[model samples]
Target chain A: MKISRIVSLVIVLIAASYFLVPLYATFQFSLQMLRGQWSFQAYRSVFADPNFLSTLSYSAVTSLVAILISTLIVVPTTYWVRLKMPRVKPVVEFITLLPLIIPPIVIVFGYLRLYGSDSLLPLTVSSAGTNLMLVIGYATLSLPYVFRSVDNGMQTLDIRTLTEAAESLGANRSTIIFRVILPNLRAAIVSGAFLTFSISFGEFVFASLLNRPAFGPYLVQIGQDRAYEPAALAVLSFALTWACMVLMQIFANAKPGASRRRRGAAFNPLARRKTA
Target chain B: MTVADDLLNPPSQGGSARSAPAGLPGAKAPRRANWAWLGLLPFALFAAFFLILPIVYLVTGAFQTPEGTFTFDNLIALTGPAILGSYWLSIKLSLVSALLGAAAGLLLSWALVLGGLPRWVRGAFITFSGVASNFAGIPLAFAFIATIGRLGIVTVLVRELFGFNIYGAGFNLFSFWGLALTYLYFQLPLMVLIITPALDGLKTEWREAAESLGASHAQYWRMVALPVLSPSILGCFLLLFANAFGTLATVYALTGSQFDVVPIMLFAQIRGNVLYNPNLGYALALGMILIAGLSNVLYLVLRSRAERWRA
Candidate 1:
């Protein structure tokens, strides 16, 4: 036991260095832009660049659109599958997991070939159309994460009982979905949205192939041209990922059961109002 | 169970007898199953257009000549030295990185979960793993470059502090081993995130029972724990393998299209930098899909085996 404890300590320390050294090195290197002393010149220069602002915002907006579309597609499908077509649950899950098995490069390659300017559909003929395609590509990439999170959330809810109760109260299907089911799935959707955002924000292969002015390609461009600013961008990207993860953890820890309990408690006042 | 089941799947007469007015007419009951599929139509269409068709196009394209005639020339051409060497190097890099990541991640997870660490340490590691697993691609390459490249902080620090020249010892960050090290950044955390739950599934009572039956620690592991954990461990290794195999941006940034990975070769081909052989590009994509698909299929098989043990 004593030997095991000692081994554990050594393992933890080694793991810590492995994870932290790169981050520390990057942060330290990013400050070397001014030369001879630590300074924020690298960060300031990165933020001041016109390409940085444009590409960052472009990726951010693209990520938001992707998240919205993913939510709209995933929520209804997962809910319907859980409520009615339980037999097709595995099929739906398998389809969503395809993106994981297929690489992004391959997927983008297919997209370019199938939808290039000379293709029949020709979605990549114009900039706006290509941007739309990029959004769809991101939605496809994030399908597994969004669908699984929402499906897990739905697993915690008694959808049948909730549907029956809402039906008895004269609520229509749309009302039950929009007001009842979606409200309950708020935490799951938010967590899935954040995950999608992080993925799309740093995505390079799709954006580069599709010819978009996105943050990922911009970072790669800077990596080739400038040194310290790339390190600065790396630090900023890491922070963005860390922030997304922290938010996801918060939502994940706020499990459905706790919220449901609070909602149940809130119903007592309504019952008292009816009694009075 | 029966009562809940009855509520969920009421008797044919029970539904009409109890709530005929409150629900849709009883006449519409038979049609509900037919129309229920309409709810999934949009998702089905989206998948068919964006997911299924592209793959179908590639698979068919792989066998066609430029004139639309059927031929396996593209696939046969894959035997050329450059393409074959790229695939070989990619497989080697992926295999080494996956093994290295899996072993280290297994040890780290074991240390956190079973090594009698503080409770908060487990939480911290799991949270950090979630972030690090997603922290890949371009910025990851930049981080590695800033840490271990020719003029990197760690390189300078090692030289100045310990009088050891890392590059002088022939460790170039642009080489195969360096790329594997960079891949490990994401691969290790991914392994931890995946295998932690599997390790948690290892019940303490099983270990106690093994001990009480007069088995040594090594015997307990080899005879029982290992047999159970092998499925999860092996499955995670394949997942890590496929992950490293498909990676593009990190390697592209680190090596600048100089390295000969399958993905980089395919990237150049797609950009029309190589001779514009669209059919050959399809074959290349097909080869990549086949490798990734085969690994995932094996992973699913092993995962099912792991699930059986849990049951």
Candidate 2:
């Protein structure tokens, strides 16, 4: 028994070292100059760099825009597919999952050929064009999450009953969709958006290929040049990514159980009704 | 379980909201037609310009010239002994890492499932795996460098106490082995994430029945467990293979793409100013897409088979 316990403990320690120790080392490395002197000079260089702030903001803005585009695209499509085109559901799913199926290298190469200045659509090889490709790639890359979550949400709903209820109350079709169904679909959409942003923020291949100075590029550049800041960036990115995942889980958890709990909370009529 | 449960029964059947009432014969008709028709556009346009067009062009690039021609020369060039070495080397590295990952995950899952404290360990295992699996690419490469790179603490420690300089002792982080070791970070977590669910897919009755029939541990695992989990295991392997195979930017940042991996080979064409072989680059891209796509199709088939077997 003791032997087994000791073996298990050893495994756990090894596993922890395997995962966490490297990250700690990177942090220490990023905090110093390459000459073995501990200094914040690397971070100072990183922050003082001209290209960084733009990359940061551009990435943020592009991620937001891409998530918005995907939301506008995914939500309605998921709804319509669930309602009417159930037979073509597999095709829709394949379209959504094509990004994962297509390797990033191929996609990046195609973008250069298809979207470069010499190509049909003349999006200049600047931040905007790069952002456009990034948006397109990020949107499609995120489709699986967005579609699955929204589709999953739609599946739980009785669309006919909900529409009937709202319609009888004189809600227009547009109002019923925008107001009633969409509000209820919030959890799924929020989760999808957060996941997309998390992914886009850390996206490497697309940013590198496009030569877009984004957060991912910044991290890479720092890693190549300085040490400590890259570690700081990694930890920061990890925290940011973790926060997004936690947010997604929280939102995902806010489904049937959350509604029930809210209803249960609302059972106290004297609490906030007229008190509303 | 919550997600799986929610997936089995989701919000599309909620207590409220429905379409316009069936008044005239065409009332439901146009609503269904319009909404459904409109939904197809976004999916179609996006898939066309981005997915299909790009892929078709990429494939064509391998064969056609900037002027115009058809040839297999590009493909021929890629399969030469020199390129083949790197290709095989990449395959070897990804295979080793995948195997290592699988072994680690299998042992960890076994421990969590059979241990006295299942939930606590399982929860921690899964949560950490989820975070770590997604925590790869450039940042991870940097982390490894910081921890184990030249002048890193580990390197310094080894140099002082063990009379071995990791960098000087031929432990080059820019080498093939270095890249593979770095890849192990993502591979292990990925295996844990993918295989845990697969392990759960193993119904407890198989083990019990095998035990009741007087089978030894190895016998039961070989006869019952292996067959049951084969598809997911295969799918997991393909995923790891494609992941390591398609990796760029991360390894490039570390080694400057000189190690001649397929991803690096293609990327060299993309970024090369000297050779300027766009056709070769495109063909290489097509080869990459085909490799990844075929693997995904295999993954889908295997995953479906597993689902059917489970059912």
Best by TM-score: 1
Q: Which ten residues in a row are the worst by lDDT in model 2 chain B?
A: B7-16
What is the RMSD, in Å, between candidate 1 and the native fold over all Cα? 7.7
**TM-score (second chain) of model 2:** 0.84
Which run of 10 residues does model 1 chain B get worst, by summed lDDT? B4-13
Docking quality tier of model 2: acceptable
Query: Model 2: what is its DockQ?
Result: 0.29
lDDT of 1 by residue, B1-311 (tens): 23333334333224455545646566645554566687798899989989889998888999999788999899999999988998999899999999999999999999998898889988778778777888888898999999999999999999999999999999999999999898888888888877877788899899999999999999998998888899999998998888888888889989978998999999899886484788998999999999988887788778777877666
In order, candidate lDDTs are 0.82, 0.69
Candidate 2 runs further than 4 Å off: A1-9, A31-51, A125-127, A170-173, A257-276, B1-35, B273-275
DockQ of 1: 0.36
lDDT of 2 by residue, B55-171 (tens): 888888789775768888878877878667877876787677777777776666656655444377667766676566666777777777777888776788778998987787688
Clashing pairs in 1: none
Tell me how far the alpha carbon of residue B118 in candidate 2 is from the true structure, in angstroms, after superposition.
4.9
